[model samples]
Target: MTDQPAAESTTTITLHLWLDVVCPWCYIAKRRVQAAIGLFERPHDVTLVTRSWELHPDLQPGTGGPVDHDARVPGESVAPGEQRVRIEEAAVDHEIRFEWARAVRANTFDAHRLCALALELGGPALQSAMVERCFAAHFTEGLALDDHDVLQRISAEAGLDERRVAAVLASDDYAANVRADEEAGRRLGATRVPFLVANRTASASDLQSVEDYLGVLREVVTESA
Candidate 1:
């Protein structure tokens, strides 16, 4: 029998990001991932896919109103004040303007639906812009994500058609998509927001440094090559 040559392999890496819009750490993680990508040798070889993971899916909008500060902790007994301080320190270091004291508690299901719509109609860039706007609205502006007006404005800013956004908001357009993403995250054993899956192999949930992300990317690139 004749010997055959090995097939050529592609070096592109896919990063699956599971995040919740209302999760402060997810926002910081997004920034860290961007910084790490910036430092990668072949940044263009990476494809980022942001998936939905709601922190408070059952919380209704405009029901109990915004919390004075974020109260959810990751198996830690830190007081609210100390948590704010710790998060503020990290936010300042990343140049992210965070007003946790003024932040509002919101159900992010609608916002996630908008993101799914953006990804379907516009693509990843629009979806990314939509997610960014959602995070900024919740974490920085203290806007209620479940409010249709707030979502409309944010979606419009992200280049989505205002009327289409309104239609989707009125109906349960992408609820299944959001649920599917959450299901996938659960299947992958993600119990927290900002869970990152690199090249569908390595996964991390705890907040890590940009260098950590870079290391993961480099290892994936080397393995693929």
Candidate 2:
């Protein structure tokens, strides 16, 4: 009788990230998580999933400008000027070029829809590239994410088919997927952008260091083992 080969064991860990295109913290959090993932032993076993979390869902597509600092952090004792300084200082630590003065606050629904399409058509690498471009466009370049032209350029830059991306932008393709992501985020009790869920076992919404992410990943691995 021929000897039978042993079955190969496989382990996969899903890291779900709920984020908004216009959120600066989400950009920072992404960088931190990426850095941590580089340090992980089983990086190939992990899959990063980006989910939609609209920060300003009610805002119109064309009506975009600098975000109202005071309006965002209501009831806080900190003055807007002081808050700006503090936020800029913190962003420097993450190597993020936060051009808040030129930042445009707009509806990110369409951008989220594009992300969903990226995942469907191009998989995680393309989705990740799309997410990074969206964040950079909003926070670094201070571009309006709601603009279809901008989205098209970003989509093309991320290696998506221009014709397909244009079709998606022209129609309501993947709109339901965007809404589903939002609903799932709500069910997970994620009220803030940059929220991360590791293996659906651990989660956090606040700004965390690379070590913090590593710790969470290690815990998930241990539990799965």
Candidate 3:
């Protein structure tokens, strides 16, 4: 009789990000994480992807109320003028533009779909372009990305076919995938956007310090060995 042996299993850690189109911090976090990865001696082994998490799903266009202040955020309402000064000061630390005066946040479900479609069509390059567009749409152009039309234009600008992006944004062609990501986010207890997960563990991929993130990723790589 021959003895049977157990099979060995191997798996790679996938960092799943739960993001909202209007969330500016997620963009900064995005760049920081990529920078950290590049700094890693073994940057080739990590996989990164964006997941859908709308900041304002129920929001409607034209009727949505502006944030309490121009360039001032709406959490605990403050005088918009006063908030601007504070935001300007905060900008120095964040080293990113908030430009809230021009920002008009909306439902990002369609935008999320567009991103997923881009991933399917052209891999990470397409996704990278879309990410840049999304950040510009919010921070630079102050355009509403939640709108299908806006998303379509941005997608094209990112080199994605207009018709293809239109088709993807028309309905939930990739809603199931987005939903799956969201479900995974929920399972991992990501209460905020920009949640970061490494390997098979469910860790919040949201806004985190760059050094802290690098430490976590390195630990995962070491443990996997």
Question: Residue 72's C-alpha lDDT in candidate 2?
Answer: 40
> Which candidate wins on TM-score?
1
Off by over 4 Å in 1: 1-10, 68-80
CA deviation > 4 Å runs, candidate 2:
1-10, 69-79
- lDDT to native, each model: 0.80, 0.79, 0.68
Distance from true position, residue 103, model 2, in Å? 1.2
- Candidate 2, residues 1-225, lDDT tens digits: the string is 111212232557789989887776677778888877788776787888899989898998899777764434312467556766655654676677877777888899989988988898889889999998898888778789999999999889988889999999989999999889889888988877778898788787766777788777776766655
Residue 170, candidate 3: C-alpha displacement in angstroms: 2.6
Error of 1 at 185 (Å): 0.5
Which run of 10 residues does model 3 get worst, by summed lDDT?
A: 1-10
Q: Write the number of the candidate with greater lDDT, choosing between 1 and 3.
A: 1
TM-score of each: 0.89, 0.88, 0.80
The list of candidate 3 runs beyond 4 A from truth reads 1-13, 68-95, 202-206
Q: Is candidate 1 or candidate 2 better by lDDT?
A: 1
Residue-wise lDDT of candidate 1 within 1-225, one digit each (tens)?
111212344477788889988887788888888888888777787777799998777787777465655465554677656777766766666778887656788888899999999999888778889999998888888888889999999899989999899999889899999999999999998998788888776677756678887877776755655
Which pairs clash inside model 2? none
Alpha-carbon RMSD to native, per candidate: 5.4, 6.5, 7.4
